[model samples]
Every structure is written in C-alpha cells, then in structure tokens.
Target: MQIMSNENAHSETDLRAEGVRVTRQRLAILHVLREASDHPRAEDILTRARLQDPSVSQATVYRTLAMLEKAGTVLRNEFDGAGARYELADRHHHDHLIDLDTGVVVEFQSPRIEQLQAEIAAELGYEIEWHRLELYGRKAT
Candidate 1:
C-alpha cells in the first residue's frame, strides 16, 4: 500500500519560494505530482501532465522534476532496484516499506527507530544529520 499527504500538496507557491519560475509545463508537472498518492516515476508524471495539457512533453516532465528535486521541493526514491520514484518533499519524515513483488511503498514512522539511530550515532561520536531507511519484503500470506 502507498500513503501520501494531500495537505499542502506541492503548489506554484512552493516553486516561487524556491525562486523557480512558474511556467505552463512546470505547472502541469507539479499538478501531476500534487495529485499523486504513490511515488510516481518520471514517465508517470509525464503521462499525467499530458492529460491536462496536450503540449506537455516527456522532456519537460523530466526537466521540471529535476529542477524541483534540486530545489528541495521534491524527493526521489529508488527502492529494491526499482526505477526512480518521486514525491513532494514537504511531507513529514517517514521511512518506506517496499513490497518487492508489487512495487508498493508504505510510509511509516517509529520513535524507537529514531532513538536507536541517535544512540548508535552517539556511540560513533557523531550526531545524526539525516537518514533514509527502506525495508523490503512481500505481503505475508
């Protein structure tokens, strides 16, 4: 299963805050990402963008996504060797549980995991700056 936050979904305002210029193609791409619940690949964004504006092209989606990711408004993840998937970066911090067979990404947060990471980091003489955790498995039958 995939969980996504629709609240404060990426908007033109976010782009402007990052000093990104709002254009038609970029808006189409951002709109697609805004409406998505699951991590979508560049191809998925391109397909969705084209639905709203026939002029949206594959290259534009890729470029726009790259620009957004660089601007810290989008996150890109690749779990279990799957291709890159994108989501809005403004969401609360959470790790991913990826279903290997179906390619589903489930988001979750655990205080215990955070505490463990902090303890481990302290043991190694370093304060945790950031981290990304991914667990891969299939549905239990």
Candidate 2:
C-alpha cells in the first residue's frame, strides 16, 4: 500500500477515534471515499479501492462502509430506485435535490425551509430531533 498523505492520515485517525480497526482494506476504502467528488456506491468504492489494492474485496468494502455508517461517520442516501450512495457526514446540515432526468445529486441548504420545519414542529407541540428532506424533480428545459 502507498504511504497515506497528511489528509488521508487524518481519516485514519478518524477511524481510530470511531473505534474501528485500521486495516489495509478499510484504509483503502476510506481513501477512495475521501478522494471522491461525488457520492459513490459500494461497487464504485470497491472498484476504485481495487485499483490501489487488488486484494481488497467487495465484502470488505461493504462491511467497512456499514461500520462507518453505524459510527455516524458516513451518510448513506438511497435515491429513487437506484442503489445506496455514500458520502462523509457533513458538519453542517443540508438537504438533497435529485434531478430525475439526469440522476444528478445537488446539495443545498435553506434557512427558510429549516425555520419553517421548526415552526411546524413547534405548532404540533413536538420538538424537532432530526429530519431528512429530499426534493426530486426534472431539470427545466
């Protein structure tokens, strides 16, 4: 395995902090996730990881992803009928806008929508704990 850079080394530290073992396969998968610009599926991750370490297995990648998700270090999104895509959990909250026509995923934040959600929850005499909002629509011509 190639020596991890400072950026990826931090990811190793994060995995350790999450009480996960720092295995070669896990590190390879984590590296792939960190370098990805788009949220990628398990198959995509496995493919990229294999390019780095041929010994990395699909089962290992899947298991590592599940472990990361359980530790709240990764976010898994199942868009429409497509398979799950994974991304690192963001420090700031945001929602997703999926383009039905092109399968594009857009991340956005809206203060007005957030405030409206809070107000609606208050009106129902319930405090908002956690929520997920996903908007799906086709691109305008």
Score residue 105 of candidate 1 by CA lDDT: 81
Model 2 TM-score, all chains together: 0.87
lDDT of each: 0.84, 0.81
lDDT of 2 by residue, 1-141 (tens): 121121223367777876888998888888888787567889999999999999999899889899999988888999886999987774467778888887777777788888999999999999999889888998887
C-alpha-based local distance difference test score of model 1: 0.84
Measured against the true structure, the TM-scores of the candidates, in listed sequence, are 0.92, 0.87
Residues 1-141, model 1: lDDT tens digits: 334344547667767987999999888888888788788889888888899998998878888888888999889997766689998888878899898888878888888888899999999999999999999998999
Give one clash count per candidate, in the order shown: 0, 0
- The positional error of residue 93 in candidate 1, measured at the CA in angstroms, is 0.3
Reference-based lDDT, residue 84, model 1: 94
The list of candidate 2 runs beyond 4 A from truth reads 1-10
Give the worst 10-residue stretch by lDDT in candidate 1.
1-10
